[model samples]
Target: MAAVTETLPGAPTTGTGEGERRGRDRFHRGALRWVLLVVSAIVALLMIAPFVIMLLNTFKSPDDYSAHGPLSWPHEFYTHGLKVFWDRVDFPVKLWNSIWTSGLVAIFGVALSLLSAFAIGIGRVRGRLWIVGVFLLANMLPQEVLIYPLFRMMQDIGLNNSGWSIVLIFTVIQAAFGTYLLSSVLGTFPRALLEAASLDGANRWQILWRVVFPVVRPTLSVLLIFFFIWTWNEFFIPLVMLTTNDTQTVPIALASLQGDRMLDVPTLNAGTLVSLIPTLIFFLFFQRTLTRGITAGAVK
Candidate 1:
């Protein structure tokens, strides 16, 4: 009788409630997705708008550029501004100085950071936590606070007005973050393998270079890119340390174009457009290696 009642056509079906719930859930999810898409698109447009304006203004005639209506599109395009900017700026020397300095910062900064992190993370040294905490504290301090003292020290050592002074300064400042990051990486990997390397007649330095370094290469690549960008964009330290026309970096050279009044709108944009290209090219070239390193860390 119970079986016959359960099989009756008039009985309530459990699937009805489930189907209604699923319909509500699907509607909510669809609405949320659309909301996120709209927000993301708006943010992306805002970020890209400045660059678009810069590029458009680069081709505008100097007469068309006015303070009253700067954002308006030009009736005629001109190449004269770029030519003037290049002729005045000395692009080749500034570009070469920037390239080698940034490269040195990335390479030396990462190497120092790795060694510091290895000591703190792998060597199990006493007070490692305190040392790392100090580095973290130092990193948080503004560059402005440190620059004056650094300048004075450079003067004392007769290192002022030299390119090497700024390079060394950047390396030291950039290494702080690298040390913290690599330390985290060091803590995650197993130490037994490192121990085995040590026992197999490998010295501490050999184990670091031969064993631990290979494991952290991907993370190192990411750090290298970061150091390059940071050093390239730096202005204050370089301005203080590098005093001569012969030693100035790209930023200093561009800043030189600005006067007490009347900044060159079109030509300034053209110069900026020039300065940003190398950074763009660098990131594009190393994009894959960076992606893999970041993902590898996330997966682990």
Candidate 2:
């Protein structure tokens, strides 16, 4: 009975071969993981290299930058570039204008988007798809194409050169994209939840606020952040609308420095870095919220 073992000609004789194959698979997997990790690290470094260079130049003196070029380290730590840019542009005023305009646009834009999406997606309105198509078309239209007409309209209403004009313009523009996105998202919403809310004696408004709003709040947060950041980076519209120095934003203020002559490179870099700080801080503060919102939407 003990001598009755049989083996096929090409088959493995024992569990050793099977175990070795598994070990080889694990080794290959580990090697692949390390390769991916190294590639990701390299990509990250490349992405941040420009920012690092900018930071270095921001603190360098004009003489230092001129002598050694952008890639070289600063000869000595210098603060004059920052002070020059801060004073030259009246940075605080520009910062405030940017904050005020972008903040208003984000809030109003999100509200407008929510209302439009609710009507199109949840209210079961006729021609809703066509309505969404229109919003999508609006989003695709270039800002340059609409700028002249918008400027004239603002001027006719005497809102030209006013911060409110910028606020109002961007709110509508941002809401167009938001509506397009939120409508699609709301289209896939659960009908059972809506029905249950209605059965619990909730009206349309109550159901929207209590059931739908809670579920879509994460998406709204994402839209809010996008709106804020987009409005902040807007250059062409703000440039056209805000003519005066007092009404100008950070971007305009920075642009105004580049007259016909060559300007101080380090000073310009300093201003650029300073302009990025507020938005960076805002993003970092809301990083967790943004991640959670994205994750929730993905799981749904």
Candidate 3:
């Protein structure tokens, strides 16, 4: 009979094959990470190139722009384009209207969405899933399809040609979205927290305002950023609703710079650049919240 052999405890079993496999895996991961980083950097540069060119054009003279090209760097930076566009567009009124309209949309729309989410997510009412399904359906419908009906409704309510008309339109459209995002966060909210609050004598509304709102403020900030940017850049709603120059938002005013009689590239570029600045600044401030807010609703 062959001699019996025993393997000892706490002994490292070495294998060249296993070691090679692990080394290969590490190599593959490192290569993939570097590849993705390079790809992302290329895409970022591509997106930034247009804005950089637009910025360069903002300072160049119209005569130089025509002689040279949009891609050409400015020989001398000047404020002529900025001043000309600002004066021509009646920017003060447009800026004011934009601030109020977008602000109203972000504030009121987010509030309504939060309350609705609280009822559906935290309240745990009957048919909550059905309610969520309806909201999802509404969100899926194209804004274009709803625009005509909304326009008619605004007309009937005598809000046509008013800034509130645009405000209301943005609120209605964005509220569905805010509800969707907030509900995802609230749905997963700890029931124990709500119960504890109730045990502490807090009412439902108080629980929502005190407990829920504080927890979901990150998501709320993300939603506010989204609403503000969309409203700021919104053209179709304002175009259909706002009749006169006085009621027009910054986007509409910037668009007015594009005339059929004469194409003022420098002024138009300057206006475009100006319109983008607020949004860029806003994102720079709130960008950290963006990643967290988007993922906070999802699982760990």
TM-score order, best first, reads 2, 1, 3
lDDT tens digits, residue span 1-300, model 2: 577867889986788889999999999999999999999999999999999999999999988898999999998999898998899889999999999999999999999999889988898799988999999899889989999999999999999999999999999999999999999988988988889988999998898799889999999999899899999999999999998878999999889778787888898889999999999999999999999999999988
List model 3 lDDT by residue over 1-300, tens digit each: 999977689987669789999999999999999999999999999999998999999999998899899988898887899999888888888888998999899998899899989988887889988888888898898768988999899989999899999888889779988887778778989999999999999998899889988888877877888998888988877888898988999999987888789988999989998888877887888788887877774433
Query: Candidate 2, which segments miss by more than 4 Å at Cα?
Result: 1-13
How much does candidate 2 score in TM-score? 0.94
Give the lDDT of residue 151 in candidate 2.
96
lDDT of 1 by residue, 161-266 (tens): 9877878888988899899878877876687898788789999889898999888888898899999988998898898888777787899878988889888888
* Shift in Å, residue 83, candidate 2: 0.8
All models: lDDT?
Answer: 0.87, 0.92, 0.87
Best by lDDT: 2
Error of 2 at 49 (Å): 0.9
* 1 versus 3: better TM-score goes to: 1
